[model samples]
Target: MTRSINEVRVVGLGKVGELVALLLSDSGFTVTAYDARTRSDLPFACKELDVRDGAALRSALTGADAVVSCLPYHLNLGVAEAAHDLGVHYFDLTEDVPTTNRVLELAGSGEARNVYAPQCGLAPGLIGIVGSWLAKQFDEIRSIELKVGALPRHPAGLLGYAFNWSAEGVVNEYLNDCEVLRSGRRQMVPAMTEQERVVIGGIELEASLTSGGLGTMCETYEGRVQRLDYKTMRYPGHFELMRFFFDELGLRDRRELAGEILVQAKPPVDDDVVYLHAAVEGHADATGERAYRKQYVRAYQPLTINGRHWRAISWTTAASAAAVVELVADGRLPQTGFIKQEDISFVDLLSTKNGALFGDLGKV
Candidate 1:
């Protein structure tokens, strides 16, 4: 006899949350969506919930097997803590280091009965998985470089940038200190530093230091690789304009203003591009000869899914978080405890129903 499947609660009513809800609901799991707004339209008993209210959140999680939080990074810790208390597996798309660290602490405690997985988005999510897979291919990894970006498919502005993702998160990355492993030593670098122009498949993009993009990689590969880092990609000339604003104008300290200005000036668009680039250099165990090379290119492809013609950015950003939920629900991943984005194998991720977003990554 088939066992009765438990319901999965998806918090946050944003685009990503909606996609995650749809994917999980289609996968045979009953999904209950909750938002901070007045909870209604309980298509499956969806409720408007104040996720911060511990008592209410725990009550909402009754009988729920899992909870996937699509809330912004700032509200992630509260949700994870509640999930831990309620014995429901938890997952989120947080890219912030401090928030992730708190989640790790909560998960590390033996009291946490269920999984607490964070950093399930694009850069910190799939990028880490793919990077780890690349590292395993070499005998001894010397350097690993990762670059990712979400941009407008067609630019209509001078900056050529669009707010396809969270504007606050983007500003945070620009203002925070970046963690990078240089010459085999981990160090914190200033954001927007070491700018470079790179061309991928005839498409030129800019890359530079950005905070929190290298989630768990530095700690995972510490003292092992000669160099390791993650960078954010953007269109050419974007860096110059940002440097002028954040540096010369001293807007780095003014996060709210930066976020407001960005959102006000650059509206989000459906037509956008998601770029991923990774490279690793190491020697084959048998061959002691010098082996030094890198893989560098940009991926720009329009994609459509779930009756929506979402560009690469929307599909990827949404798909990464969605796939993790599917994996957990299917028991392909751990149901509880602290889980890293790299914890899930690439092959396993590609095999999921929503995994088509990755397509054939080719041989990197």
Candidate 2:
């Protein structure tokens, strides 16, 4: 049985965590937030603990019905293991493949007491759901192209971007090989290759393969679609400058230093936009009589939540993770098992308590 979720815990109170706790609390869940350093500014119960210490993590999770990890990708695995051991439902915004795979393994271990729903934020979260929603409308699907970008609404500089998110996650996305379905087969493609021009809201931006945005869709739609891929959109010259910074400058080998230097150069911005585009081309009928193409394209800007304006990246990400937790809490999802974003109904997602905050999320 899916245990009733009441007392909830949120760890790593960073850019996205604070709002997550607020949203969940506003939706009526008793929220308690945690961090390595203490936090008192939030409107919820707060605690300080090192998640790496097993005793500390277990103690913190013992009384919670659920735990959401907003930590960096590297820290998610240990937190997930702790949650499973404590029989608490787990959710996260991790875009790292290995971390997700490990979570899946834990969920499938046959002793899991609750659901494990990772990849609960944007890109892999909402974008993947939008793609699956579109694909289901067609009798036969040919191609599904997914793209997302988070950038400053007003840009200045060669890179035309800001570090309003985790630099380590962005760096990892840029460096890792992306998975794609090419000609009805799954394959690994080098990231940053296959550059293409994408125009949304009358603004032209360049897009190229970035890792982890597709989540497990490559595995989900392997033989169903002729071609499936995901890319990250950015200002036209952004890719060139990044290549020059990472490859030409030989910073690829030093990912941590590269993230540090990049953050030092372009700090987080309050005025940012989150771009989403999902196009699905398929047959219009059961007999494959007609061809059809559709897309869910929008540019999300910051919006006010509880009288405070949030950055597009922060609120969109925060609401998505929290909304998924809401769904599980209400039993819209399985009580105990691994859940995929594609399995989520898009309409239900937009109708959740936190989903309203997320959909009120576009147009720069």
Specify the highest-lDDT model's number. Answer: 2
Error of 2 at 101 (Å): 0.7
Q: Which ten residues in a row have the lowest lDDT in candidate 2?
A: 355-364
Extract clashing residue pairs from model 2: 299-363
What's each prediction's clash count? 8, 1
Point out where model 2 deviates above 4 Å: 1-3, 286-289
- Write down the lDDT that model 1 would get: 0.79
Off by over 4 Å in 1: 1-6, 38-45, 286-289, 292-302, 360-364
Task: Write the residue-wise lDDT of candidate 1 on 284-364 in tens digits.
Answer: 665565795546444756565556675576567667777777777667877667788866877788887777558653222
lDDT (C-alpha) at residue 135 in model 2: 94
Top TM-score prediction, candidate number: 2
TM-score of each: 0.92, 0.97
- lDDT, candidate 2, residue 203? 88
lDDT of 2 by residue, 1-364 (tens): 4437999999998999989999999989999988999887778899998999988999999999999999999999988999999899999999999999999999999777998999999978989988999999998899999999999989988899999999999999999999999999999998898999999988889999999998889999999999999999999999989999999999999999999999999999999999999999999775456888988888888978888989999988998888899889888889898999999988888899888754665633
